[model samples]
Target: MSGFIMLKHIKHLNLQYFIKNLPQLSHIMFMEPSYSLQIYHKYSYEYKNGNSNCDDRTHKNLQNYKFKCNSNQKNKEEFNYPSISEETLLALAEYFESFEEHCDSNYDVTYSDGVLTINLPQKQGIYVINKQAPNRQIWLSSPISGPKRYDLVNGIKWVYASDGVSMHELLNKEIPTFISSKKKDIDFTILPFGGKS
Candidate 1:
């Protein structure tokens, strides 16, 4: 298939997957057929002796030798981690790797003359962050604004979503209810009590 065709196929598959799994996708754009065909020729012919490289004896031997060594090492480690499933351990390792990447991607917090700013990508519109710690309190505000204060943390369980809900629902209402339901110790004031005598 031409590069243009391949790109279209890839894009189509991606769109289809998103449509089926995620109900939140607003739209999916497809690559133009003309653009796909032009790129196909460029990718297919640019490689040097592609099939011959695979057939090389030295390369074949090296690949097989490396594969056997890797297989044996993996087998040995399987027994070593008998207490923990290999899949779970692998997942934990993958999670940490992605966590490190997330930390790297987050903006640096800067403070200057009573103003605190967190520089982030401009593509994100009207950025709002609600952070909370188990020890202290829930923080609500734009990270670009000022110093973060942590009083007695409001028992919250907010979720960042594209759904149209008022900030009251986003912060005050739904979160505490969710937390209260989840943990019995988390006593949530779902509805404010009357202050009347």
Candidate 2:
């Protein structure tokens, strides 16, 4: 049978196994009838022929190789991250700028050029929060919680993908420990954190 006919009859398990064995066959079969296989084959051919000049080899699996070349590869939500990240970091910086001054003479909150540095005295430790524009992330280096890279997800929060924890959660928990000494309780609800903003 022809490759097209074989593609019609192949089961999912067999298809995966076949793709694993004949990696080039993925370029031949993993596509819709109307989709162009020429570009996919060109990449697979160049990849197999020792043309390591381009980044096609980095896709891991030769299957679905066509997506790497497609301009619309990223989903809609992913495209929104840059703007969300910018807003989130800016909100965080603004809040800390005002909050730090009243808390302690020894504590310093400095926000300059997309970096927010919180210096707490008496071994409370230094906090460095900065906007990583390229990665679309806000990096936090906290004394109590170590480090985490937060992505701006659907809820308008800077969330660490690993532990499902928001940057606000860590700050609300840890910030009070160092700053809530003046008979005043921290109101985390008022901060410009999560929700549809």
Candidate 3:
């Protein structure tokens, strides 16, 4: 209880220096219930149905809470089988191969079997696009967006459910930054637009 009050008081008084200057409180602050900059909603009892508005949480014994609004979950039938995902991933790999051939020597793109790998210029890192055939999803490990699973929507585009941004939209926004800044001629047509490029 005192730990909670002291944490609250410290924030209320904005006593960052005081806390930092005293190393003794450091052990207490990070112990078990760590006080952080973000507010944590720790429910004592099982979470039933409420307003259905929650972002992120964790529960060891209690029932976990879920976001009821804007879930953006689509029907499994909407995304086609292996053909759609395989074709899309392969097409992207070819586009990248063309880009790597035209772009700087540092950039590289590769595709084999059902996986596509792209190594960016400088130390920017690589992008991995692979087909999860069973799930009918295109999983991407991008240098800019980390890891994300994309599902084809309405047979028109590959969409990320968490933020509703399509695979084409994200690549369109980011891929140009690396190309346009260095080269004079960059064909954006190769990048997917309203549909598969």
Candidate 4:
């Protein structure tokens, strides 16, 4: 069978699995048929040369795949982070500073250089929240949830990349529980800039 026919057959048989497992394959197959044919020919040659481990070969090829990115583009499409303004940074800093007053004597909360460090004696660990200016994201190193990057969405909320949990919501849920205090409602509405209130 021709490589094109074989690919069509594979798609027909397991379209969902093909899309899920080999997303790049679907892209090449649909967007660049000639490239897909080249890939097929290369793999066929490799298979005929005694490289029978298809999984290993596929993984290796994927690792070597050169994803194209335009250097002239002002904003790269791969990253979802938006541009954060200076006023927004100050507002966020102010918001984090408020946590210091609410924290118990045992817990040490400090805000400096757009970074918020929370030392929880009861938890026996530190939580670090910092603004990554280049990425326009807020990174959180949490004792409970490991590391998470949050992007500013809707010009106001810093939302987690994976779970879409807002920074205010995450802190309100986590910090109060960590310090054994009642859940405090954090106000994210008071942005310094004319951002979405």
What lDDT is reached at residue 89 by model 2? 64
- What lDDT score goes with residue 189 in model 2? 35
**TM-score of every model versus the real structure:** 0.15, 0.55, 0.54, 0.47
- Answer with 1 or 2, whichever has the higher lDDT: 2
Task: Give the CA lDDT, 0 to 100, for residue 69 in model 3.
Answer: 9
Residue pair clashes in candidate 4: none
lDDT-better candidate, 2 vs 4: 2
Q: Which stretches of candidate 4 lie over 4 Å from their true place?
A: 1-103, 121-123, 180-196
List clashing residue pairs in candidate 1.
Answer: 3-40, 4-36, 4-37, 137-153
User: Each prediction's Cα lDDT score?
Assistant: 0.28, 0.57, 0.54, 0.53
Ranking by TM-score: 2, 3, 4, 1
User: Which residue segments of model 1 deviate by more than 4 Å?
Assistant: 1-13, 24-158, 162-185, 189-197
lDDT winner: 2
Clashing pairs in 2: none
Candidate 4: what lDDT? 0.53
Window of ten residues with lowest summed lDDT in model 3? 61-70
What lDDT score goes with residue 68 in model 2? 37
Candidate 2 C-alpha lDDT tens digits along 7-104: 33333323234334444333323222223244345445756677644344343555354553242224222456556666666777676665664566
lDDT of 3 by residue, 83-192 (tens): 77776777777776766644668888888888898888765788888988766678888888799887665556776655557787787777777663545554433544
Single out the weakest 10-residue window by summed lDDT for candidate 2: 27-36
